[model samples]
Target: MENIFNFNDESSINNVEIHGEYSLIIVILSIIIAVVASYTALSLNKRASENSFFHKNFWLFLASLCLGFGIWSMHFVGMSAFSLPVSMSYNNIMTVLSIIPAMLASFIAFYLANLPRRNLWTYFFAGIAMGTGISSMHYLGMYGMEMDVVYTYNPILFLASICIAIVVSVIAVYIFSTVQKYETNYKVQLIISLIIGLAISSMHYTGMAAMNFYIPKGYEMNLSHFHSTEMYGLAIIVTLGMTILLGILLLSSFIDRFIEYRANYYDPFTQLPNRRLFEKKLHSPKVLAVWHIHDLEHINREFNYAFGDEVIRRLVYIFKTLTPSKVEIYRIEGHRIALIARDGDSAKQLKGSLKEIATVLRKPIIVKGHEVYLYGVCAVSDANQYENTPNIYTNVLAVLNYPSITYNHDIVYYDSSIHTYTFEREIADDVNRAMNDDELFLVYQPKVCLNPNETVGLEALLRWNHPKYGFLSPAVFVPILEEYDRMVKVTDWIIGRVCQQIADWKLENISFKQVAINIPGEYVTSPLLLKLLTQKLNEYGLESSQIELEITENSFVKNMEEAMRAVGEFRKEGFSVALDDFGTGVSSLSYLKQMPISTLKIDKSFIDDVPISPKDSAIVQAIVTLGESLNLNVVIEGVETKEQVNFLKGASRKPIFQGYYFAKPMQPHELIQWYRETRVED
Candidate 1:
């Protein structure tokens, strides 16, 4: 043991002392290389966990290569900085082989860092594995030196170097694990990189301190060639090569991040900022307005979806061209676009802009060589009035859905006066509950024949007895249900209940004419309604003539062809159809000529002040005359006084009257009792 191992004692006289000097510039450069490499590896590791299996493995491999080559380059650069009082060079094969340990160590470190479940024990084992690899690489590279000298190490300092390396590895692993929690925190990354760089440098220098080199007795030192240019050139080449590789990796990562950001924050179809980005940009004192394309679904159904998409693109383009630069637009949802204004006069300016856009939208837009007419309405709200952006967004969406505001092509500013919006929102949220809890029911109003002075038929009116808000009128909740696309289900429920009631009435020996049901505009146009009515009638073992369908004039306004076809189908099946709420819509006179109807019921608005109001009397006279001219059965509604009845009786033709004048809407039992009493009197 004494012959093989020679402990280098400082007091020995035969040993030659050789001190090495360092180039300050090369030392600093080595430290920078270590830091850059660490940052790149850490950044890569951060993204690895978020990637797919293939991408995650690819990133890990690249990170390992970067850190491995970086450490190798830094080691050589640091070695090139140290100059001894002798000529020294390294074996090429050994120098290359030393990098294997570094890469292996890097892979281990990153793999452990990316483990799904980690603990103190995981980090400690990772540190131990990494520290062993680093120590082996350092000693192996040190031994690769070819020189006419003997090498020795101080036992205590040698162990101390290994300890320092292990400690640094533990710390690097811990910091790498912690720093990943913060996203893109460049300041913290820099600080961590610096600390890692300093720690690596400390371990390398400590290993160097442990090393001692002495010239053999017979060897002669060539001091003149101590500074080798070739060696310095090698270090520079390695550093540059590693830097270029890292730079390429960084560029690739940046491109990936950019694509990810675009996908997350922008809508692919409109190429506009999406709801996520819009919500992020919401701040105080900003005016928010949402423009909803009311007839977009109709357009999509009539044409193809592609044509509808083109329409939206064109609308967005028009909005961008017409609105000022201060107003930022976002594609919030299907058929809905949102705008935010940040200027001082944003509310007034935004309202004006909305009106301009609405006017422009009224004109038919040419898409795919087809002239497509679209109806849009804007709901504007002040952000300052709300507590947060979410509140503003919620209320604005509710306001946009207001039945009066929809399809009007007008801009409505939200205020306390728009209480209908709030009430409608409540109704929409609770309507399903209303159905499940049997809160919805029907009341029948008797339509009397004026000439015979007897009850002719009954009109079924829907009523909601809400647990929270009692006795809600159909006028308030029906439109809400329609706006929310829930009318079809409610209408189905209504039809089923009416059919069962008619069956029950027959069992009780109650004799009456057919009962009239007011079908919503949506139900009238929907193909499902006819099928449902047929199914219900057959299920109840009743003929179609026992039930009557009352459709409003506006029902024809949506899709006249479909509404007319559906009504025609109903009439063909032996069911009578009444054009309810007559003479209320703008094109009622024009549509009356085409509508296939058995009855025309005048709206109550024209009958509320009939005797005194000359205009009301004249309108009523014209409607009655029009019904008689067409030979259609006319029903006058909202007659609460006998004077209105006398006036109607004086008309050229007698018509059915339904109002509070004779009998209000009643329950099933009351209607049965009233029918028997009326029949007895007749």
Candidate 2:
């Protein structure tokens, strides 16, 4: 065996240069330990910051042990790779004590990394602290080496190793902090771990290069009880132990992260993806349909919330089982489920799937021995039609929430027309403010007796002069108010203003018959309508006969029995009831015989083509003959031409007339002036 250095020739010891060779296997093992330890520590530190106090402290402690012991093992393993001429061993106590600095350094680094906010100086200081601790650990471990020779260091190389440790630690810490938010990005973590591992190896090898070991002149080397093999065995055991510990910690961290991801992106009840995941997927090009359980609230109100939840689960189950495989369903809202079509699926396919789901939902879902039926509508939007994810989502929501869909039950697709719905939604939000700001008012259109051509009554029409939109038609804002259920308030306001206007007319000694105020079909059945009407009539000291209640034929479509009962109550209260928009609805003939009414007003659609279209003229004649036979006063609406009036005159009875032919709807003051001027003309 050849010794790299020999102290037997004491006289030549000063001139002999000591050099050592390294075991490639041990060097490689040491590098592996460094990388594994760095990754484990960084992963644990990330978990520490995201957890509760107890778990955070627990993770932090584990991270410190992993990093500190990991660094110590690498140092000893590297030292074991070097073959010295004389036998060498480490002081067990000193070697064990050197790990304290590494652990403390790890704690400092982890603490700084988890800070809520940090600047450049924070990392610089953290690096300096960690680098100093690492440097101290290396030097202390070197000092623990037991041998007969004295060792010195090259000052420049020693300082350079410390600087290298600091610089690399700073870079590694910055990288970990930057990527910690992206927990799923393991590749970046691995790359950072490699950097840290190489940096540790570089510092260790650099420090080793700075070492100058020599035998003192005339001094004998001690080889008694010094086993180089035992040192190598110890290094191997420590490295293996730390590696196993770090591996377990890494596995635990991954398991915890997976559980957290599931909790975040999944709906526990339905076992489907949640809104959070759905929103994330919206960034891609796809067709999306949102199905809302419109009647789920009714179930919740009828039964208990638990029953509602069970119904929702059953509905979702139906959706999953019936929809195509390409459709991905998500529980985006409590009562809404969003369906997304994959790359190969088109909007048409998605719509077909929605229809299938709706068809299935029509069947009863038996829960708790009670049969529950669900009614929902689906709104579809294609990402390709929109500029971005937000626009697609907004447009889809607008289409879904459009007022007509509530009653129509048809699957609606997002298109340019939905912008009108979106605008109406905005107006719906401002309706209360509009009422408060005096933007809402009313105008009157007078109804005249045909033969005498005398103004008998007026139809009070509600109008909104929105500051932004400027004079929104009742056809526009009225439906929005009805959809949002804000019409109750507006209806109240209308009754109050109409009553006040009638009182003002009486004070002016203007002889007027009755003012007809149109009421929404939904409100016709509400007790509030009767209550508010009675309250306003009494408040303004007006008679019920002075205010005629005009309701469209569709009002009876929902609950004809209830509507008929409500109308009978109004008629008994001395209020005139008029069936408006005649011949437009399907159940008109049946309802006309049952409903208690004083007047029949033909819808403008049939009147618009009358006298020009013989069919329309025949229809109008039949309605007038029917109204006279039923002993109901008939008013022909939209009579814009003299020919139409002449055709109406041929009817057996003279019907009242209301249209632009007489006069357009006018403001209150304009109505007064028109009334005075009309009387003068007559």
Candidate 3:
């Protein structure tokens, strides 16, 4: 039959001085392989077009094209180097080499930019499959010597074959995942996973298809003749290596793009995830960690906003030192840095670790030779499915507001129960109402003179009347207010009301004497708060001596330099400052000396259990003795019983006050009514 294949007629027509029928076929297949490889190069170049390195894309594309064509040429040139007769079996082997185009086509399809740079194993796997195909065909061609084929499979060697395939395939995919870069999109991870899966499938199928070559007469296949005859082995190595290397370099360029984009999204101030970065990476099924700088606003007002900004930076540095590599850090707005643990990595231990870090951070950063210290409220979320980063974030925020955990310098992790959250929400609602309705009332816990039955002044205790929940105690709402932005608003309302109430009584010919109001650390820095108090005093025709702003020792010296300066600001404005809860917090001799405070209100805790609880009694005595020596007015609180009052009078702590014993806090009308009623009862 006449040959219909046009390439068969190429020998008779004489092109490029063809040496053998097999040579003609090899050249034809080589040309096709070269063309397909060129297309692969173009395909890769197309993917690189949007890359920052894509300008270098053209160079890579040209290089790939030249190299791919050279691989095909070299394969044939190496084949030509073999000393082989123009046997029919040899012609068949050359025909089988045509499949190289198919392999190249698949390679083009698989080399992707959106995959992980870690999966270069895909390319290595490809090399393994190609090598297997080449080696199998070479052995099959050797059988064309017309000898009986003998099959020998060693168990160890057979197992090694499987091992090599898997190892190479896995490593290839890993390389691809590692080098393949995508935009900051998370799909890149999934894409790399898919590509590795494809590589495994490719290796398996190619290995399955490896078969023996059928030999024809007039061909002697020997190792020496084989080396002399065919450069196919070397061609296989060089060509596949070049192809895999190109894939790596190409994929790696995109990975570099992803990394560069990620770096751009980092927050400059904190070196954590910026707002843009957080929104992008925050995902479903994630845990959120919230870290709050507890005294940032106070820091800003006293030392200037720059100090606050530095505190934020310093906090970030502490977090960077404390967290694990698998944890992702995000700067959530101002004064909060959040950590999102990568793959739930070490998340269970996050709270404890964060607490320790917070304690370490509290040890004062030596900023400009000043020991600048900071504190944090850290909360982790419940490890539940509903916890997308947003929900997890909410959970963590809720914990930061958890009064017991936050106030005590402890970190709290999430619990499934909603009771604490509900409690906090209710308190916030009441606080807001108290701010608006003037329903927020103070209880005058009386501080009585030890020997005399006369009341000198009342230490104002905060109380709230919820339209729904009845009278809410200061213990529940005060700390909540203190931690958030609303504390300043609430404090202003309390101060304004107290001053006005005292004024009305004086007008009524009742000597209300001095009234003490608790001032949150936030209020101390507020110049507007002072102005508000001044306005109220002037309107009510009250003197500066009529009002006292009581602050705890903790609040008085939280940011020492800031607190000292702010106290001076308060004193300068004619409002007297009291060291409320003095012995209870940081009782260093320096605080009493440095603070521009007028009165020392011994903490209610020390006064409540005094004399009976010897510890409490000593604290009371020490605080009283300190105040007496310093010429500071000593006011004792929490006098629930007459026996406690007797103890304070016996201890020589003169002019003391108490909480429960005086009168549980009353409204403005009740306070005036109680004063009028006190004299009537007397």
Top-TM-score structure, candidate number: 1
Q: Model 2 — TM-score against the truth?
A: 0.42
Best by lDDT: 2
Tens digits of per-residue lDDT for model 3, 1-682: 0221123232334321112123444444443443334334433443442223344444344434443343334343334533322232234554446435434533432433222231344455554543343333333333333322222334554444445434644453344434332121224433433333333233322322332222322224343433243556546745664566466546655665555455556766666777556655666635677777675687788787787777666667777888876777788567667777655556655655776776786577765556775666667675565524444544564566554554334566676475356656656666776667856766665555534445677666677776643444454456666655677777777777777667667777876567888777656766676688778888888887777888877775567777788778878877678887676686577757878888887766676567689988887777688788888888776665545755776565456565544565666667767666555433
Question: Candidate 2 residues 430-515, lDDT tens each?
Answer: 88888788888889999987455478899988888877544554655676688888887887888888899999999999967899
Query: What is the Cα-based TM-score of model 1?
Result: 0.47
Sort order, TM-score high to low: 1, 2, 3
List per-prediction Cα lDDT, in the order shown: 0.76, 0.77, 0.56
After superposing candidate 3, which stretches have Cα over 4 Å from the reference? 1-426, 450-453, 680-682
lDDT of 1 by residue, 1-682 (tens): 1322243576245666566678888788888888887788766765575422236767777777777777777777888788775777789999999989988888888788767667888888777766776677788888887877677788999998888878888887877766563323567677766766665677788889988878654456666655543555755656585666678576757776566557767999888999767765765647888888875878889898888888888998999988877778898777778988887676667767887888888899899899988887787778777665445654575576555555757777777467445756778888788878889888899988745456778888888898754555454577668888888788788889989998988887764668898888877877788888889989988889988999888889888898889999999999999988888886647778888999899998898788889999998999899989998999999876546866776664667888765776898878878777555433
Off by over 4 Å in 2: 1-5, 8-21, 24-70, 84-101, 109-288, 298-308, 342-352, 368-371, 379-399, 402-682
| Candidate 3, number of clashes | 45
For the record, the alpha-carbon RMSD of candidate 2 to the native fold, in angstroms, is 27.6
Taking the candidates one at a time, how many backbone clashes does each contain?
A: 0, 0, 45
